[model samples]
Target: MEAGGKMMGMQLSWIRNPQVSAMLLLAAAILGLVIANTGLGPGLDALKHAHLPFTVFGLDLSAAHWVTDGLLVVFFFVVAVELRYEFTQGDLNSVSKAAVPTIAALGGVALPAIIYFNVAGADGAQGWPIPTATDIAFALGVLALFGRRLPTTVRALLLALAVIDDLIGIFFIAVFFTESVSLPHLGLAAVGIVAFWMLGRIYRGKRGSWPLRIALLAVALITWWLVAMSGIHATIAGVLLGLVLSPAPAESARERLEPFTNGIVLPLFAFTSASVIIPQVPLSELSPVFWAIVIALPVGKLFGVTIAGLVGQAALRVPKPDRMKLSELIGIALLAGIGFTVALLMNELAHRSAEDLIVEGTLGVLAGSLISAVLGAVYIALLSRRYPAVDSTERTARDSEEYLRRTDSE
Candidate 1:
């Protein structure tokens, strides 16, 4: 019974409800905007500015510090969890499965930064991560628009690219966005890191079930708090917790958790973070920063990923991508340029130093994410008729299930 429980939990952890996730994400963002702009913004701003008690057993500070330095740790933990899972059992674990997308993700990340930096420059260039993320919700939502016409390969490629892009975005956050370090806390972080790994081993050795994961949540929260205080970005905590307890190892555990993470947790996070006020920044007087973001994110992302994917195939003799047209492929690449959640987080983190610049970056993300979604949708809808991606794996899984049933009947 214990073993069965474990397996069931694992299955639950890995469901991919992309449609629901995308819609909820968009709704959340829209809701956030509505709330923030409709008189709630002032309250939020006041709350953010309001000084709350930050008593840490002995050391005390303000509330905003806690939010920035503390609460956001949960977000970071999720990011770590996703990163580690991908590196271990997810799309990134297999080279062949990961190759094309990784290459595309790399190009997508590099060129946008280059373009953003050149046009926007290093002064405000710290905001580059804003334009880096490929909001999976937005991209996938666009794919749904094409429905039956879209190639399966294009969808697969887009997802892979987004994951790899997410990985890169994390590294950027860790390296670039961080503030002056505290060496003592950093060392302590190393100690806590070892402890987390040890915990993972213990749970795996026990062949942990859902209860075990639930039990570990308290520890993970504690671990995240410790690391957040230790000067590391707190959001890394979320990713770590996810990866550590990732039921993906056990098929059943993946079933329950994947759906929640994809359909609920991820969407909630997107909505919470994306609700920025589109305050009247007059279009007639838009900044060059805006135009740079406009050109750099969409144009740069499409050209960069498309060209890199082509070059990789041509130079390395990589296998030709199956069932996706050059046009549809490029379209998918464009959609992958939509940057939102990560950008907003970064903007909030970096705003003190570069407020004006961050606004432009934010605008760029909105424009790029929106444009990529629309254009990619139209382009794929037109070409999807010719290149329908036959999902061989899906077919094989169904076939195997049918064969097993027949064997059982016999």
Candidate 2:
């Protein structure tokens, strides 16, 4: 029993690591791709497209939709929890620390869209938002693997930048993807959200209360259902609920739910999203959307983030000691291009009408993200060698202590 318990503990520990989670996501995606191209492709495709056995609130969702619209909401909820923490206490608590990353995130978003517009023209313009995201898990995972000897500031800047980029990506999803909105359902969702927030506040004072926990879970599901029926994406419900929940309870929820999200939700989403049969055509015949995403993710993010971050630092008159070197900034900028998860969601939403475009978009996101990961790893490794004695692990430990102190005081 002791040995089995130890094995389970080790498995949980590995799943909690960002590096391991990222690798799982990648492996799932690759498995999906391979499966889609194999003799069993049709079976998997049919399974993904098949409707669920049951329907709630008169909504029938396919397996793929269940992953994206239902399970993926947990992932978004975690993101929103982190975003709220940053705004209220962490790096983005002050404008002085937030400006550069916010500016750089905007640049990272804009340039990719501009490139997409120019390359895809009117035909594929709907996918402009696809490449404008930075997958935080993948970026942080790569950094953790390669940034052993780097300073803590690099990770901080990357976190801020990725969080802000995702904020913009979420905005795009909420704004651009809605076909129609039902005011009645939306109103009900708003009420549910208010109830959720109030319950969270209550839970902060009533920890370990199972009834309250059950009520919270019930209210969250009701809200998500209302959002799904309201014609807005269901994931927005997670964001709204997370942002409104009180701090103490929110932190607890994040810790409890993070492992489930990392181990199951994200990997399921990735596998479903990437299970696209590669196009059989030559490169020249591929959709313009593919080429645009391929070019925009790495190149657009590199130039846009580097230039805007440099400019923002200069304009804000940052201290020399706080400013990152040009080379380090470039490396971080390259890392910003790892836009796997959100990009895939955007692609699926944008090209839902055209099956062929969806296939091409999947390939584009995977290929582009791979390029960014490779280049970013190399760049970060070179930077690590320059500061061999810095010890990022020690810096991370210090940061964690500071974070706990801030949270406790708050």
Candidate maximizing TM-score: 2
Q: What is the per-residue lDDT of model 1 for residues 106-204, given as tens digits with 9 covering 90 to 100?
A: 888888778877876656666666666677656776676564455456676787787778777767767776776667765665565565556556666
TM-score of 1: 0.79
Residue by residue across 41-89, what tens digits does model 2's lDDT show?
9999999999967886699999899899999999999999999989878
Total clashes in model 1, counting residue pairs 3 or more apart in sequence or in different chains: 41
lDDT for residue 150 in candidate 1, whole number 0-100: 59
How many clashes in candidate 2?
0
The Cα local distance difference test for each model comes to 0.62, 0.89
Candidate 1 stretches greater than 4 Å from native: 1-16, 54-91, 148-151, 208-215, 240-272, 279-281, 320-324, 387-410
